[model samples]
Target: MSMKTRTVKVGPVMMGGGWPVSIQTMWKSPLAAFSGPGDPSLLAAADEIRRLAALGCDVLRFAVPDETGADSLGALAAASPIPLVADIHFDWRLALRCMDYPIAKIRVNPGNIGARWKVAEVVAKAKDKGVSLRIGVNAGSLPEDLRGMEDRAAACVAAAEREVAAFEELGFQDVVVSMKMNEPGEVERANRLFAAKYDYPLHLGVTEAGPLIAGIARNTAALVPLLKDGIGATIRVSLSDSMESEVIAGREIVACAGIKKAGVRIVSCPRCGRDSFDTHAFLARWSGRLYALKDTLEVAIMGCVVNGPGEARHADIGITGAGDFVLIFIKGEIARRAPLEEADKAFAEELDRLLG
Candidate 1:
């Protein structure tokens, strides 16, 4: 079901036109308070952006509510290695200001961005700057006329259609559309509807998706089917949890859909009564680092011998516990042994050797 779509380049990455579907996450911090190139907050954000990019987030978005947000995000975008998107609502001026920097895209709700001319203003700037736009149509905020429609999914698609028309009318076609709803079914229905009619690349997501467990469940349910259908060009698993969780979950969802399958896959066992190694603690400590690796490898973090060497024999690297010793193995062969206290350091060294 991998279909061709019009490609939109965002800085170093390209979306659609049979390109690999990208993973994205919103920056959780508020940038309005930080201003200028010298601000420490922006520097910290830049460092975090690098870390997120390393963790497989292809694009990063920040909410630009006012001029101050635009000011800070502009400075940060100048230094960011990966492309940055300015999520602007209401004010088209902020989009203009954000475009003053190297921001790659602007996300706007046609309903919120006001008149057709306002959108045109943004679109004109977007075209001039070689920037892209995402027509963000959320279920919570359909048009005034469409609000009374019984079918929420149809209303979302209609809103997106209207926005897409608005952009094309202005002769600006570098567009991506998203029709998000809290319910996974509604989101999927809207995206499927839009994908059937339009060639614009879609930014797939479920909005206001709850915390870690609920968010991943909802986003996965909605995105997987759409990805397999070749309906999405990029995906963001919006969550009430950390941004890292969102990016990691997005990667897993894309892989699960069989759309794209190149990343560090973790095969960790859930500890039980016979558990020895603390799988939970180890995974928490190493998850980010493992995910940041560029190699396509399976790393198994198991609790005991039963779940480790024998069960995860195909894994590129693995660790488990037996009686009084923690064992590190490569492809089912025990390569290093350490006491429980020294497992972390020993596993780190073994992982380096394995990856090398």
Candidate 2:
């Protein structure tokens, strides 16, 4: 059962309100690092954003440390193909300045943005510009008053609640909420508590989730249950890696949770002594291109013919190493056979034909 919540539009994308769970990733570097006020670097960043969007990144966020960063992001936002989010901290003025641009969303912690009136000022501008606000609450950044709370998850919920109340009081309700904890258990607890208490869209993620492998593991453990129970509106797999990796992890998590069904699904067997193919290397070379495919198809990369063809017989397409050659199977029938060196090209040709 999908959790029902109010929808918040971020540019052309709609999340929550029974919408499909969307994937988001934060820019790995500061916006200022990308370009100056009027530099070609902005175009480079725009090109990268377009690539990430093709990989299924629904929203892209950048850290706005100061006015200069805000200005840089404003220019990128105008050219970006997907919705952009400005992540602001400490300075309410940055949030206000971000609103002046075409940025789709603003993320700020009410606790760090100074007093209530400062939040009100940002909220007023957000409302005036028709931009949605994401009240991000992290366990490491909880307010001083709430830091001593015995329940860390409860504390996160409280912090988010306080900020949401402030937004409501100002008659600004176009809001999204996120409560993140690095620990999987606490992350689940915090998001669960927030979901039970509020109907606002919940952006789910585990903060500081480490590098690619560990981050994917932690985020999957934390987000799977919540997503399966229909809790999250949007999700970001915060991997300390490339933005492409983060978006890929997010898409896999959503697909694993059964929240999303349209995309290429890759299934490969773990190679053992019975294997003849280098499953790992082949998958590594093709994973990105395979995932980027928009078609709803299952592609299996198996190590050997033993259980490969039988297990994935229902797959639309499959490949397995047999003897010194690779066998390409489509709909349970062998479609083509190619040597090891030509396997990739053979698979690509078959895939293109299937896609066409």
Candidate 3:
């Protein structure tokens, strides 16, 4: 099927156009991270976001829960080097306040924010202020009217439709929709249903998806199909981990699905009998060194030479273990062989060279 296309403007960023799904992370800094509500933690968050941007994160979101947090927006926006999305809930005034800032996007569940006019006001403000709006619908936080429904997906889909309809009615086409469920299948089905019904840009995520490893796997399983089907415009790997980890995981997910052209791709065997090295230890070392290459290089870390180089010949750089030493392959040819002890450093140096 030819994917239905929709374009949305978020601050200065334009999403959709079959744009490679952008990676996003919500900043978890407590108010303590700021001196107070309006206190500018711009430097602190910007520092973290700089690392994220270097790691190839396309968008960063911060929770604007109160007046103080809302006030921080302008400073953060002025200082931030990357696009920023403001997450607002509970108060329409907060969203209204966010409109005054230089945020690239605003994410709010239309259900919780009071009245139809309130939503219209928010949408209008975003439209007037040139900031994009994300109508985020979550299963865990479904409207009270939708609670205890016989079918939760139906309830979520209905809620999402209503929200989308609101935006459509407002003549606000610069909108993206998200229906997040904790379960992988639920999110998968919900987005599928939404994609079939609506032409709006979609932001896909499985909310509250647990800690690091589990969360990444669940987000991947849910997002991969929809993404491959040309269903989503942006993606967020919502890990209960650090923002850096979330960006890394999101990039990896898109890369693994063969959708994202940038970012590192490390392919190591799950450690079978043919393996001769400490596969687990090797991956640990490799993952750290990977930070330097970060979002720019794709390296395959394979356990055995048998299927290693051939399976990963497409990779920019890769390594295959041969008895005591690992052969480092750049593109398809063997560049050099390094002993296990120096493999991580060698890989890092080689990756830097490749990126240069």
Please name the candidate that would achieve the greatest TM-score relative to the true structure: 1
Mind giving the per-residue lDDT tens digits that candidate 3 earns over 1-356? 11556877665555776656777888887433345434555566667678788776788888887887877765677778888888888898888887787778899987678588888889889878878889899888888898889777788899989888888898887888899988988898988888887888888999999999899989999988877788788888998898878887877777666674655666777878998666688777567447535456566778887878785576778887888888888878788888978877787787777777
Clashing pairs in 3: 37-68, 263-295
Q: Write the per-residue lDDT of candidate 1 for residues 268-343, one digit (tens) a residue.
A: 9999988888989999899988999999988888888776777557788888877677888898788988999998
| Ranked candidates (TM-score, high to low) | 1, 2, 3
Off by over 4 Å in 1: 33-35
Per-candidate clash tally: 0, 0, 2
Which ranges of candidate 3 are over 4 A from the true structure? 31-41, 272-276, 288-297, 304-315
Worst 10 residues of 1 by lDDT: 29-38
User: lDDT of each model, Cα atoms only?
Assistant: 0.88, 0.89, 0.79
> Which candidate, 2 or 3, has the higher TM-score?
2
Between candidates 1 and 3, name the one with more favorable TM-score.
1
Model 1: how far residue 140 lies from native, Å = 1.1
- The sequence of per-residue lDDT tens digits that candidate 2 reaches over residues 1-356 is 24899999889988789988989999987766444545778878888998898889999999999988998889999899999999988999999999989999999977688788899999999888999999999888888999999898999999999989878989987899999889999989988888888899999999999988999999999999999999998999998899999998998899889875578888899999988889899999999888888788899999888977774566898989887888888877888999988999999998888778
The TM-scores of all predictions, comma-separated, are 0.97, 0.96, 0.86
Total clashes in model 3, counting residue pairs 3 or more apart in sequence or in different chains: 2
